[model samples]
Target chain A: MSRTSSDAVVVHQREPFLRGFGSFVADVWAARTMLVSFVRKDLMIRYRGSALGIAWTMVKPLVQLLVFSLVMGYFLGFGDQIPAFGFYMFTGLMLFGLFADQLTGGATSVLWGAPVVKKVAFRRELLPLAAVGGALVNFTFMGVVLLLAYVVTRDFPNWHMLGLAVPALLITVLFGAAGAMLVSALNVYARDVQFLIDVGLLLMFWLTPVLYPWSTVQNTLAENGAPSWAFELYMLNPMANAVVAFQQALWPGVDEAVANAAAQRAAGEPFIADFDYFDSAFATRLWLMVLAGAVCLWFAQRVFARLQTGFATEL
Target chain B: MAADVLEPGVAVSVEGVTQEFSLRHEKTLKGLLVSRLRGRHPVAERFRALDGVSLQVPTGSTMGLIGHNGSGKSTLLKIIGGVLTPTAGQVRRRGSLAALLELGAGFHADLSGRENVLLNAELLGLSRREIAARFDDIVEFSGVEQFIDTPMKFYSSGMFVRLGFAVAIHAEPDVLLVDEVLAVGDEQFQAKCLGVIRRFQQEGRTIVLVTHNMGDIEAFCDEVTLLHHGVVRAQGTPRTVVAAFRGLLAEDERERRAQSAGGRDDPEDPDLGFVRVARVVVRAGSGRPLDAFVAGDSLVVEATFHAERPAPRFVGTLDLYEGGTLLHSTSTARLGVPVGPLEGEVTYRFTLPDVPLGGGRYRIAVGAAPDTGSPPWHQVGDAAEVMVALRAESSGPFALGVTVDRPTRV
Candidate 1:
């Protein structure tokens, strides 16, 4: 190791923001290797004692998909009503899994790292970021299973429609990362934040359109004489809009099934009723959520920086 | 405080630093609520662990911080290490720094020792390549190579700290803050650690060590600071500051004994007798108060006494002790000088023609008793301290002046 010169000196002062946040940014960048090491440690610790090890990442989700397909597809006969119902549900669940894992892991990250945080002086934001990194690693593992399903079924997505998945994935990730940073810092002060996070995630799971299509919710709201603002309020949930976007990108059967229903009705033939799956304002909602998520992420980082000063003493 | 730049050659400069912590007595919500319902509210008490402490450690120099427990020695070290941001004031430090506040504090118990080494090194700001280069040296020094693949939980506590110490020393930090961690491991390993510290000194790396062991402070430190109740009481050469710290400890001990003695009401106890040694002072033969002296100098011990009732025969004994070992002792009875039935106040003095003592701090213990072999009516274990300097050519507890005989071969 070479000697650090006098110009590269470090000053530990209270409220160092006056010296500029640039130094903090530089410090974090300098510790990038430690970030990678922490992410690897988190991933390794999760599977350390398991018999199947990383294979369990694939098996666990595959089993959840099977159980969901059996209960919601075969028993409810939605397998016949909707084309590729299994694919649509699987893609939505995968995205939701990413969001859930990021939130839970991020919120409890500081508590799990009590030893290192209390003992070592480093960029503490790395702890939650590492958790988010670990969750992304798991997301990639599940994506492999989804790709194989697409290959095995021979039902490829519309290449143009698949481009929409980028914004959808960004929305989920931005919100997840933001929530993690905010909750993790708060959790250090009061452990109750994690339990609150658990309840919030459970509520968010049902609010997201994973188990059913967006049209089902739209039709139900219409029948209840709900106002237009009520529908707009539902779209305000970034996770809901992201889920709808992912389905538009990855699920190919919705457009064809809707066209088939219209043609049969025009011929005066007995046809099963089906609603249009596309949302006219989908693009606008996606951009709006993305902009909202950026603001949220910036605010969360500020909150984390403020709270982290107390972490060493409190822990 | 002005943000004055630290002068060149100063590795660490802390100015008017104070650390305040809000101590919460109740941590759980349930416990808090129950206590509040009973009309007891646990308010956060602000405790200042360090109060406006300032110091400068010169680059390439070793500084020792000596203080009693809770005297802010470790807190000051933590502030310098950047482990805890001071509640007030600023710390400016040059070059890369590493703190060995607690050994193996970053280790994961479930991970293998090899994995922990990599992870801990990264946590301490070592790059991957640097760790790879030093990995073998660390393992060899720790002496746990055969069990490197095993989880640290399987290793003994001694092995655990050795591995921690090994990695930290090899980090080659420009400035290292150590908090009494060298006391760990076996004696042989401890010696190895001391050797490493000496090598670091030779390399001109700055080190700030906080320890209670005065021997280490004297042997390794170029400068020492004594802290009492979160403030610096003295700072100077290791010998002078260490002597001042010992004086502080003695004063604290005496105050504690006095407090406890007040609670005891044993009238028959000889310690409560009327005859008492009022004050004791040690000085050189020239009538100067003894701060220090060259070896073999004449010494004078004076004691003032008050007697309400005294026996016909009495004894005034003075003892010179280096630590707990009594080096020399004398009494009026042994000298054939009579200190008889006395009243009111009297002064007793003893003069030694020549003193043969080591180059270390010694304490003067004076006592007054009515009869021989009876409990002392008044005794001051540590009345005054005198520092003796050894001759340049001599070593050990006694400065025995010896002459080498020059003669023809017989």
Candidate 2:
């Protein structure tokens, strides 16, 4: 094993694992229809025979919004004062849900489909991508629920925020596929990875700006002169940009003119002013997330190709 | 005799393929559980599953792959099929190859038989148009038409096998590879599968078959390779290769029971043996084919003598142990069968049908008798192995648990 990560592991002692061009490309591509059918089958099978069936995709997000609005709106005291707090949490929840869903679903796709992986040779990458796509399909219902919420609320969501869907899907998919590729390869050699994902998900859930706002965390870190390692969490956390973008999209002008006025008034004087520095350029965060997602995806492709050779025997 | 023309192009070529497996021994069950749960270094040890295996299959030729268990027969097929990648070696294929190493490798249970047909056909590189054109024929051939709409999870094992086989043969590839899938279908289905293979043979589609069944080997293969312990021990025509296979089986019997060849001293393995040890071995036919047993073929048992000094007149008992328990046995003392005087190297040729035995592994026990005064024959050594094969089922003795009780006197 090389110290640095490599996509290809050309083992010369034995016959190569992914030997010929016909199998490497054609085998994967030949299974294109199979991949589509399998992805469709997975979706059908997942929601099959259930009372709500796929309605749960929308219902789950709506239910979260209803309960959060009651608790965060009345109890926590951030009611109408913070623009659209209900929409704020809904956007965060939707984006965050995508990130979590992609990672969990994609990460386990290969292991979950060990039957196909071990028994035959097709594109192993398709398994995880199918998972990402399944979550993507479920996004449609969630869209309807978000639209319904926007109609019910007075705050009109701007058309600019509609861009979040594509980038969110792409970024979440890239990160999700990367995570899945890495974890699926790792899980073949270790059976206890399910438990590892359980812990990792729980920790990352609170760490990401899902239930709360980034302002909450940024305010805490700004109080201390030394910016913490937690700052990099924004870069690494896949949901941070998407979630913040959604909140910015649904709730227009969240941090209003008060902070800018105060900053200009205090600028000539020898006093520092508190303003929304990170907020001024929050849309770029989603773009950065897209870039990060692509990077992870590229990294994942290389990693998976190298490690996938070990899967047949390892499984 | 069949024509011996091989097409110019190579359908499949394997060059210097070697597959190594890491056998984790340092981590026993206890160690593995301890380390894995504790998050320590996972233990692994290297094992060479395949070593320097190379072969070529010219287009439009029937090649037979024969090997004993653990001989890398399946591994080689998987690599050729691209289901498995070799740790080292290169496999080159010119055109599309439909590898049937295991039938229905990609079938889904939740999908109906009809649905699976499309999925499986598409998987075999068939276009939707092709699958649609062949749908009715595939359904009719599978004979699962009535149950086509039922989820495959509800399919009977035989129905599942039929559907899989139906989809596979219809897919039609330039190179067809078949493993032991014929064993799953009924006699009629097996015959039909063989017929399909014969058609492929006639069409000049390359076919490589891996089967323990000599019937399949003799019937279909124009060329054969016999493998032993991951090495090509023999390669030639079926007749010559099978003869070599029998020779290898006999050699394997000899190697396996090298310990109990009528031992002169106390057997050292305290754990495996202690009961006045003797020997164990299988009676081989003239050619010594492990998979060759016929209705009245004369089978011979070769044994050497072992006894304590001042040899007692011990009765020679041959008990057949099947599945670790005695099924039926005979002794020289209780002879309806004849037992001649003992010599240095004794050989007994018993008619195959005389034993009324079924198929399976039977241990040969040759125990010694004591003089009338001595304890009724202290046991000598106790180890011998024999397998009965029926011409009907060359895969091996199909008699799984059919035990014959010695005809008790009325």
Candidate 3:
């Protein structure tokens, strides 16, 4: 608050290479209050006039869970063998919804706040960060719905659920923030990127094991005589691994007989899979995914900083 | 004042700051790719909006930037405000800063006026606690108390600007950057806003204002900088800088007139060259041609037309303009005045029995056209310049006679 010092703030050309990254981090940290305000405003304005308001957050995922469960569990008869198919699908859908929302929202964050971005001098990264943060808030609301589903079904979560779910959720958010940062910056130059992302998210939703489990993918690969590297490459998708991690945390008591039967029925079907929740190799791969996500976050921050220099002109 | 005396500080210092923007001709990847396939490189033309401009602002003085459009006055202000970063050099500031770079720049239309006040204040760098403490005062200052809870989309533009200005001034930053936002709103509100800014000046806050209004620059600024083509052309006390700015503007206008006159040899419409407006003269009712006239005096505007090819009929139009705003316009065709067939030269005159205009510099524009659905044969803007002197104190575009009456002792 003191205004008398001449040396308090100096803005100069950033140092070349990675040296300025540290200062960038420090700047973002200093503007954390603005970031929080942005996120709060984003969430409030989004639901301001809606009758359902914040309830729409929970309602969207719940509806997605019911529709997927009804189609895959009844008509398709794929979920007949998976015990508590609805809850399993809900966990994956919840995580996927959070990831998708963050990605799309992050991509448009800068463009959406063009008025502020062009006129105000602040940490521009806060825009995408707020977008991801707002998605996380919605994710928390859906988490409550998940908890409610657990109580209704008389299924209880153990301490291991906390141990695993918290890290899974964090990793998902980190991945989302990274993706949002990259796409949002790209979106400023190419409006086509927004539409590309819409199509990409649809493809990614099917690619990830949101409605199904991971086992079906593996079994189908084995049956098709595909090489093992294909399955490894498939597992390398961070969202695929994150979805498995979320399922493991939320639906640990899946009936194996029913799961296998559903797996048998879902053979050769797109987006139907049964995951191995306790696979040591999958856990290791999930850890690697988290590390990769962190690296991506770092890279995205650098790209965003470089692109943001021209945001005012571009906007 | 205490801080200024204690520190003798420089509030803002710009050192060799240059802002370069890459103007991309192709914004889409597909367009870029198509250009690549055609053996052409997608071009990004670099423009230097601010070219190594450096200045030092003392802690407690108000500085005004004056320039024509695209002269980079706003760019310099933005750079100082930190809304834009220079591509080279550096900027150092002594204290917290708030910028009114654009009025209502970030207010959400769907949000109520009260909500936008909080949002805009915080965006300007005020903390939530500070905004909460000063909310009532901000609202009162804006005079939008009745519409505080109404969505901003429903509010008038004046209300929006008032609220935006109110929040910005209340932010109490050490350095304030304002960019022509005072040009909006009513006269009373504009005066109120300027009063707050004057108060800020008295409190020793550093202010940098960008405006095209020479009056404002003279009235408010301790010093002035006049920019031309992204560089400072003049910098000194308000009087010297404003004079230089006006000189530059007049020079520009003269060059533009020369160019336009040279280029007008080829008429767009073939029939337009049949007749041309040669001269325009303005005279008082006393029959003396004068450059300046007093309000309520009878004025006569006469335009002479020379016809190269005989025209069957013609309509002469006269227009009076103050600055860019047209005050009054009349056409002989509209007034049912008859016109011309025979040709060498003809003079048409329109008389205003009482010039109702208030004091201001004014221009007379004259044009002539074939009366039968053809484009104007010749049109001349500012064919004659006249100054209207105020007979008495007045406001607005015109002065009307007023009668004051006292209430009867019923």
Q: How would you encode candidate 3's per-residue C-alpha lDDT over A176-216 as one tens digit per residue?
A: 99999989999888878888989999998999987766777
lDDT of 2 by residue, B1-410 (tens): 01222234666777788887766533234556776687764335566667888787767788899878888888888877776778787666655666666555556687778877886777677888999999999899888899998888998877887887788788887777777877787888788888889898888788888988775786689889887777778888986786677557655654554545443332232222222224434554455564554333445554344433333233455555553356666665565534333323333333343343455544455554432222223332234445565434334333434356899999
Candidate 2, residue B222: how far the Cα is off, in Å:
1.4
- Error of model 1, residue B301, in angstroms: 7.7
Q: Please, what are the lDDT tens digits per residue for candidate 2 over residues A171-265?
A: 66678767876776666666556457768977877787656656557656666654666665654676665565566555543454235436556
Local error of candidate 1 at residue B331 (angstroms) = 9.9
- Across all models, the iRMS values in order are 2.6, 11.3, 4.7
The candidate, 1 or 3, that scores higher on DockQ is 1
Better of 2 and 3 by TM-score: 3
Please give the RMSD to the true structure for each candidate, in Å. 5.7, 10.0, 8.3
Residue B64 CA displacement from its true place in model 3, Å: 0.7
Top candidate (TM-score)? 1
Specify the highest-DockQ model's number. Answer: 1
Error of 1 at B314 (Å): 9.2
- Whole-model alpha-carbon lDDT for candidate 2: 0.64
Weakest 10 consecutive residues of candidate 1 chain A by summed lDDT? A1-10
Q: What TM-score, over all chains together, does every model reach?
A: 0.83, 0.73, 0.77
The positional error of residue B298 in candidate 3, measured at the CA in angstroms, is 23
Q: What does candidate 1's lDDT look like per residue over B1-410, in tens digits?
A: 34545677888888899888877645445555676698753334678889999989998899999999999998888778777788788888878777777555466777889998998888877889999999999999999999999988899878888888887788887888888877678888988989989999999899999887776887899999898888989999987897788668767755665565542232134444457788887788766556677666788888887775644546788888775568888777777876567667777888877777767777788877765555555677767777776557676668788667788798
